[model samples]
Target: MAVHSNKTATLIVMLGALLLSSGCGNLAGHKNVDRGLSYIESHEYEEAAACFDAAEAAGENQRILYRAKGILDKNLGQYDSAVENFLKSLAATSGIPGDMDFDTNYYLADVYIKQEKYDEAVEVYDAILALRKRDKDAYYMRGMARLYSGDHDGATIDFNKAIALAGRNYDLRIMIYKALSSNGYEDEGKAILESCLNNTDPNMTNYEKGQISYYLGNNADAQSYLELARNERDMDKAPVVLLLGQTGEKQGDFNYAISVYKTFLAEDPDHPDIYNQLGLCQTNVGDYEGAVNSFEAGLALGNNEYSKALLMNEITAYEYAGNFAQAKTLMEKYRKAYPDDKDAEREEIFLSSR
Candidate 1:
C-alpha cells in the first residue's frame, strides 16, 4: 500500500485566526497579519510566511505570529517546525484568548499525528480534554490517534464520547463513521451510515449523501447521488467530477474513469490530481503511452510536494509496459528526490533487482 501523505487541518488555522482577531496589536502589525491571511487564502504559503515574519519584526502579537507561522509550516509539511511554533503560540501571554488554548493544543496534536508521533498526539489531546472535558473535536482526534496506535478499544471509548457530544451533527457523525470504517470497524460504521441514510434530513444535499455513501462503501448509492447532484443547477462541478472518476475507478470501470477524467481535464486543464487519476485509468486500460503523457503533464504543473504518489504511479505505468529501464531510472530519481522516504528506498531495491 502507498503511504498516504499528511494534510494540514484548516480548522486549526481558522480558529487561530479567530484568536488573533482578539489581539490588541499595533496598526502596522495587524496590517501585515491581514496581508498574511490574504496570502494564505490564495495558497501563497511562502508569501504568507514572509508576511508573518514582517509582522513579528514590527513587534506584532507573538501569539498570532507564532500561530500563523505554525499553520504555514504545517501546510509546507514542516511538522517539527510547526510544532515548535504552535508551542510558542500556546506559551505566549497576550493576543490569544484563554479559550483558544484548546485550539492551539489541538493544532499541536494534529501536527504530531501528521508526523506519525501518535503517542505525542495522544498526550496533547489528553491535556486538551483535561482542560475542557467536553471538547468533541479533541475526543475525536484522540480516538483517531488511538486507532492509529492500535488501541481499538480505547478508540471506541473516545468515539462513543464524541458521538454523545455530537448529538444531531450529521457531518460530525459521518466523519466519525468514516474514521471507524477506515480503521477496521466496518460493521459499526455501516450501521451508523445505514441509520443516517434511513433518517435522511430534507436539508441535506445529494452531494453530502453521496460522500457519506462513498465512505460507507455503498458505491451504487454513491454514484446515484453524485450523478443527481452533478445535474443540479448552480452546482460546483469540480469535486463532483473528481468523485465520479473515483467511483468509476473503485468499481473497476476504467473506461468510465478515463472518460470522466478527460471531461474534468477539459474543464480544469491545470489540475494536477486529475492527471494522476487519468494516468492510473489509462495504465489500467493498457494505454501506457497515454498514461506517461498524463503523468508528465501533471509533473509539469509544479506541485512537487503533492506529486510523490503521481511519480510512483508513473513509474508503475512504465513497469507495467515492460519498460524496466525507464522505471529504474524514475525509481532512482525518486530515491534521490526523497532520500528519507522508506517507500522510495524499497522501490529502488525492487527496481534494481528487476
Candidate 2:
C-alpha cells in the first residue's frame, strides 16, 4: 500500500530487456525454455520458476539459467539470492562479452538499487558504460543512483545526456521530469513538463501529456487526457486504463476509480495491479467483501511484479472485513513468505491488537 515515488521505480525503465527473451542460441532449443518465457509473460512466476528448473536440469547453458534465475529471484523479492545468481550469470559469461553481458549487469545493478546499495549500482552502471559508451539506459539508471545518493548535479548532467540520446521520445523525457520532480527539483521538472504539455504537434501523444499532467498534480487534466488517449486508434490501452483509475483515486473519487478499474478487468482479468487497486478502492468505499475478493483474486494469480503489495493488500482487506482470523492466517503466510519483511511483522502486531 506504499505510494511509490520515481526513486522507488528506479528499475522501471531498465526491466524491458530482462522481461523479454534471453536470446541465447545454446538455450533456445530447450523445450522448457519457451515454456518458461511464456509463464513469465503471463505473470505466472511459480510456473516460470518450475519451467526454468526443468530447463536447467536439461542442461540449459549455465549463463542462461543463472540469468533467468536471477530475474525470477528478483521478482520474487529474494534480493540476496538474486544478487548471487546474477553474479553467477556474469561469471558464467566472463570473457564471452556478447552473451548476457548488458542484461546481466543491468539487472544486477537494478537489484543493488532495490537494496539501496546506490554506490554498488553506480559501479555496475559504470561497468556497463565502459562496455558501451552510448548506452542511454546506463546513463538514466546511473542518474537515478546518483539522485538517491545526493549527487544532484551529477544526476542532472546524466539526465541531460539521456534526454539528448532519447531525442523526440516524449515518454522518456516525461519520466526524467518525474524523477526530477520527486527528487526535489520540482520547479525544474515542472518547467520541462510544461514545455511538452504545451506542445500542440500531432506527434505528441495524449498518453505522454496525461503522464506529464499527472506528475504536475493536475489529476483532472490527467483523467481527461488519458481518456482521450484510450480512445485514440491503435493506442496501447493498458497504461491509459491504469492511469485513469489512478487519477480518479488521487482525486478521492473512489467510485469512479472502481468503475474504470472494473471496466479494465472485464477485458483483462489477469492483471494483478488493477485488482490490487480495485481492492483498495473497494476497501475505501466500505465494500469489504468485494475488497477481499479482489485481493484474493490477485494473490491467486501469484506475483505480478508487485508481490509484496498484493500480499499486504489481501491481509489488510481481511482486517477491514473484520475477519481477524483470516487476517492472522494470511499474516503468518506473509511472514513465512517474506521473512525479511520487518514492516509486515510490525503490521501483524498492530492488526493483532485490533
On TM-score, the leading prediction is 2
Superposed Cα RMSD, model 2: 7.7
Q: TM-score for every candidate vs. truth? A: 0.67, 0.74
Poorly placed runs, candidate 2 (over 4 Å): 1-60, 65-85, 267-270, 299-303, 306-308, 336-342, 352-354
Best by lDDT: 2
Evaluated at residue 21, the lDDT of candidate 2 is 29
Cα lDDT tens digits for candidate 1, 1-354: 222122222223322334332345433356777789777655576688789878987878776677778877776667778887886666553332366566677788888887889987887777667657898988999999999999999988998898789866767777878788788788887787778778877887888788778877888989999999889998887777778788888889999989988977987788778888899889989999999999999988878654777888999999999999999988876764454466667878888888
Clashing pairs in 2: none
Q: Alpha carbon lDDT of residue 86, candidate 2?
A: 73
lDDT of 2 at 69: 82
